[model samples]
Target chain A: MSLNATLIAQLIVFLILVWFTMKFIWPPIMRAMDERAKRIADGLEAADRARKELADADTHAAEEIKKARAEAAVIIERANQQAGQIVDKARADAMLEAAKQKAQAQADIDNMAHRARAELRGQVATLAVQGAGKILGREVDAATHKALLDQLVEGI
Target chain B: MTTEAPSSSSYILHHLTYLQLDLRTWKIVENSQNFWVVNIDSIFFSVLLGLVFIGLFWPMARRATHGVPARWQNFVEVCTEFVDGQVKDAFHQKSKFVAPMALLVFFWVLFMNIMDLLPVDSLPTAAEAMGIGHLRVLPSSDPNITLSMSLTVFFLCFWYSFHCKGLKLVAREAFFHPFGKWLLPVNFVLKVVEELSKPLSLGLRLFGNMYAGEVIFILLAAMTLHYSAPAHLAPLTGTAFFIFSALALVTVGLVAYGKGPWMRAWLPLLILPAVIAAGSIFGFLPAIGGGAYFQILFATGWGIFHWLIIGLQAYIFMVLTVAYLSMAAEHH
Candidate 1:
């Protein structure tokens, strides 16, 4: 076959084929490939983000537990210190009350013993005056003693 | 071939002639068409092969998946990727059409070239049985087909050159290439020669190879069909060999002189001689071995080799077209 009408025919055929392929064939396949690539990229990014977030969450959880434990420890320590302070204050108050009570008792005992000695001294003085009055055959007043009687009582 | 004995030359001639129809006369004209004549075979086969391509690929493209592919889809995908790879390698501009157009040129030309490797007698004999006179199946063997396909590529180059360079730049490049403003005529001549040769070589290289290949097959077929004597085979086969050699040498000269990839021009220098020598030797062997055995060996060997040539020519045609388009589309 020489070049003639067949050139036109082949050209038309070639044009039609190229058109068909460009319109129908190339775009969808390429788009699918591109979409698949994008999806893969997106998935990988999401997975990476998830992994990072998971790590962050894990660290956060661990830190929170540690913080809670530290807070609990602090609370316990404060409670123990408060408890010790409360006990020490109660013991000191008790000791101070006990010492006050003991001092009061000693004071009371000293006052009672001094009163007894004074009562005894007063009784002996009265008795000595009465004995003197009896030996002189006379009752003497402790309130108004004469000078001579006072000197004789002093010598007795 | 002829009345009594199938003359080797007329056998080749008979096979070479295409079935043409004169539209003016509305009659099947074997030869001598001064007016609107069509190679009925070429048009029919080109259209048919085009339809075949559409039928085969359209569904695959329609149902194409991004995930794992089915068997036929894989084929389509591979073909698509191959053509796209060629375009991506050669053409850098972001034209939407080049990759698919490359795919078109590749598969269409590949299918047409494949028709040549079939048993030469099978289709013609079948057509004759169906009351058809002649059918030349290999459309790529027809210079009309190759030239017209290249004609489209030439137009694309023209369009893209203007598109990328603008008319002013294209004109400037044509007139002011290697030489400055003073030597416009020389530069113009050189630019015209260079640009014109792109499509000319593209068309003729494929046409020459396929045409020579057809002629060789016809020659070999004729040798075994007619010549029983060893002496009768050599000159006939040698004549065919030189014809192929001469065609290769002319194209080699063109590709050697042409400014594009110079290595491609030298490939024929390697392939053509080996094929011619083998064909001639095989043509000689048939006379001693009584035709069928040697014919089978020769046919099978050449057929396998030609299948490779078919694929290579189609690939080369696609890549060269893309390269030329790339050059044309590059910014001035």
Candidate 2:
């Protein structure tokens, strides 16, 4: 085939195709590829940030839980100590009250003993006075006898 | 068979002829080419396939997704990316046209070169059936078609050189290079030759190789076929048939697998003649189909090997185009 009109036609087709491809085909696909690359990069960055945040949150939560637990332990120990002090205070108060009541009861018993002794002496004096009167065959007076009885009691 | 086919030589010659249209007369011509006459088959196929190439990519370009691409889109994208990468590597200056241009060149040549794989007789047989004649489909095999492409590249070379280097330096470099300003005349002639050779070789190399390959296919086709059976050879029977078959098979194997220097040297002298004689002897045996078995062996073998050549030719054309452009654009 001699070089002819076909060359021109083919060259035109070649140029047109090349131009069409350059203008329309290339830019968009390349842009899409660039966009895709950026998306992937951004996605990976977000993932990295999220992982860091999650790790921080995990550590923070653990710290908060640990603090709460420690506070609870301290509270429990303080409560135990306070409870022991209360029990000791109650025991001390009860011991003091019991000692005071025992003293009061012993004092009452001593007072009753003293009264009985005085009463016994009076009875003895009266009986003695009455027997003297009976020997002398006369009646005994209470006013003079009372003084004597008191003196006799004092002497016993 | 098929309307009593012409002699094998005529078959081959007919296949080789192109459907030409004389531009001056505005009339169709065949059996010979004239000035201003173009091979319409090459033009038609080239234009048609060029459109198809663009058509294939057009949709992909439109709907090209940022996400997972469609299969066809992926294919187009990969090819584009490859060409883009190659251009980036080669050309220092970023030209918007380079990658897409390379893409067009590569796929266009690829599309044209692949036409060779179609069975040799298919197009011509179809043409004859249609009452038309002499349609060669493979466009790259035609020098006009290939040279047109390379000439386009050649124009671009100077275009870029003048554009990038400015007219003064281009003129200076063209007029004086290795021998310097003292030998301007020699340098001018040498420069012209050098410049002409770049595109010349690029175009002609592809043209020659492809033309040779087409010729070989034709020759192989010729081998299988015979117009008239040799009048002497009667139908074979008994031991003679087996012996001829054995000899033919051996010759075909030797011809097919014989890459050795001895076989290459002797093939024309001793081997081919022996095979032909055997083929005539076995021509009456319809199962063997004359010497066509050997033709089938070589054709199939070469056809298989031609896949690499097709891909490589397209690749080489593209790479050299880029290299030429790069040298022009970046050269100080």
Candidate 3:
């Protein structure tokens, strides 16, 4: 068909509008949307990572605490065992020393008793000799008196 | 008043006549002497028909669904798809605006064209009561409306050319293409003339076809007796036969004319023309030489049918505009 001034004018205006809208308006709007989407995605990802990291940290801390408590228990047990060994050794040594002392005391008492008995015997004999001299025939009697005392004790 | 009826000739003549606006010195002069002006009866009803179409489809515009479509939605979808297909086939451009514009144009023009199918008396009856003189509903039949729409399409075509090819390229194409540089001035003037003729031809084509159809219907209606005359003498039987035959011919002729896929080709050719003819003959053709009552009926019927045509015409015009724009942008 033939072209006309009015038709041409209309076509021009329509084209201008379409081109302008596509070039200037649509791009910015689309870009803005893209940017907004990316930002949202990034935000979500960060939140997810943060949640995971917190969980991991909590688990790691708990594990470290468990290991520490176990080590502390082991150390306490070792210390208790060393203390018990030292106490047992000390008790054994004390028992041995006490026995030695008791034995020495017993020996000293026996030796003192033997010496006193000998001295008493000597005194008694001297006393008996003086009494015999006084009573006529006591001089030779020390040995004889000793012998008689022995013989009478034997007989009884 | 019924002593003698008007002849069929008079009836048709009255319905075909119009109260025209005459321009004098760039101003509209009321009651200018000898200004050739007349109204096509179909136009009044056609515009009302257009309004109705707008009403029906307007609701669809508001709550569009992505899922299952309503009947109206489906209709609209089919219309848009058809228009889109036409645009895609005719004009190869990633035209940001052209396709949608074409869709609108096709639907509007299609609706406008379809308005011719309503009964002739629907709008005229109401118009008569309101004392409105000579309202025609078909925008395509109005040279002014057709010319305006076509001219807008032409404008889009040129605008795309200038925008895409640039003034330099347009000037070059006009002056240098298809001939040597030696014939630049002649070529330029010829190209300009050719470009200038697009809207003129487009508008005139539609107007002439529609106007002729309207005139035939008027002639047929005029064969009836005048309303004031006795009704028995009027040749209603003969008129009805002639109208029916003429409508059938128009419908058949319309269908046979187009070259397209079998199913859809028949619509643009057959149905469209039939609607146009029917709208003119039954809707607008009966109002002339009619009594107040007859005129009212004729007007109302025409109003009812013309709504389709108004929308169809608008859609067609919009589509043509977009297609031309796309072509110009790409070809240039």
Candidate 4:
């Protein structure tokens, strides 16, 4: 084919297409692409921040659990010590009560023994007087010997 | 089919001719060396294809989003980004014009070249019914269109050279740098030739590839023009060609779909049947009369291969334009 006016016509058409594309087509698409890129970057950054915060919260929760466990262990140990003291006081009180009861029983026994000894001595003296009266054929004065009998009882 | 069939050479010539119009006389042009004549068919097809490009992209451009893009928008973005990537790679300078210019050249040329893939006679025959004597659908095959595009790039190179390097530096480098001022005349002549050759080679390379491809398609179509002619051995040759082609198709299908170590081992042996099949087809070609079946086969194969050529030529044209502009922009 030979060079003709068509070449000029095509050149004009080509220029117009280029101009149209530059004016109407390129800017909007490029802007959208750049805006999308920025949005993606921001989303990724937010995700990273959320992950870091979650990790921090996980560590904090674990520390709190450990602290609560330690407090529980301390409270259990103090309760065990208090229980031991209460048991020791109860045993001491029981022993003191047993000792006091034993002392009371011993005092009752001693009083009874003294009364029996006095009665026996009075009977012996009456028998001695009766035998003398029988020998002398006369009664002696018993009221006069009461003081001696009382002293004899005390000595016994 | 027409009762009086055209000869094979005439068919081919008819396909090659363009629908031209003389601007001065305002009439259809045929067999004239007039400088004022324009190829109207090339202009119509090119402009129509350009409109198609704009139509496809303009809507998507309006709906482009910062969020997830629709499929059509994604496709448009992909094309835009690919051209942008090419412009950025070759032309390091930031300019508003180069990327869009490259996009226009690439898609416009690509659409023009794709016109070759249509059945060679389909549009021309329909156009003939409308009383248009001749039509060539592929615009890239016309030297006028390709040269016009290359010449535009040439002007762009000159514009950028003057803008970026200034006239003083460009003129100085043209006369002095390559061979020094001692050989200024030789350097100037060499530089001018070198500068002129860029557009020449750029335009002709595309025209040459497209023209050769168009010619082959026309010739393949011409092979079926003798359908009414009688051949003595037509039935036998036709049957033989069919059987061999079937065998070839089966072999190809097996290689494509069959799987396992046995298939791999049989791969080398497979070539034997293919070679024999090809040999038989060519051997029976002469006796097959019209050979319409063979024409279909060749056209299908060539059409598939031309897809690669079409896209590649457009890409090459766009890349070379960017490279030339970048070279012109350089100081030395």
Candidate 2 has which clashing residue pairs, if any? none
| lDDT per residue (tens digit) for residues A29-126 in model 4 | 88888898899999999999999999999999999999999999999999999888888988988888888888888877877776777676657667
Worst 10 residues of 3 chain A by lDDT: A1-10
Clash count, candidate 4: 0
DockQ class, candidate 1: acceptable
Q: Of the pair 1 and 3, which is ahead by lDDT?
A: 1
Every candidate's lDDT = 0.76, 0.77, 0.55, 0.81
- Error in Å for residue B244 of model 1: 33
Q: On a 0 to 100 scale, what is the lDDT of residue A153 in model 3?
A: 37
Listed in order, each prediction's TM-score against the native is 0.67, 0.78, 0.48, 0.78
Over B21-76, each residue of candidate 4 has an lDDT whose tens digit, in order, gives 99988999785678788889999999999987887788778888989986567788
Ranking by DockQ: 4, 2, 1, 3
Supply every candidate's count of residue pairs whose N, Cα or C atoms clash at under 3 angstroms: 0, 0, 114, 0
- When candidate 3 is compared with the true two-chain complex, its DockQ is 0.02
**Stronger candidate by lDDT (2 vs 3):** 2
Error of 2 at B4 (Å): 2.3
- Candidate 2 stretches with Cα past 4 Å from truth are A104-156, B1-3, B31-33, B227-297
Query: Residue B162 in candidate 3 has what lDDT?
Result: 90
iRMSD per prediction, in order = 1.7, 1.7, 10.0, 0.9
lDDT of 1 at B6: 59
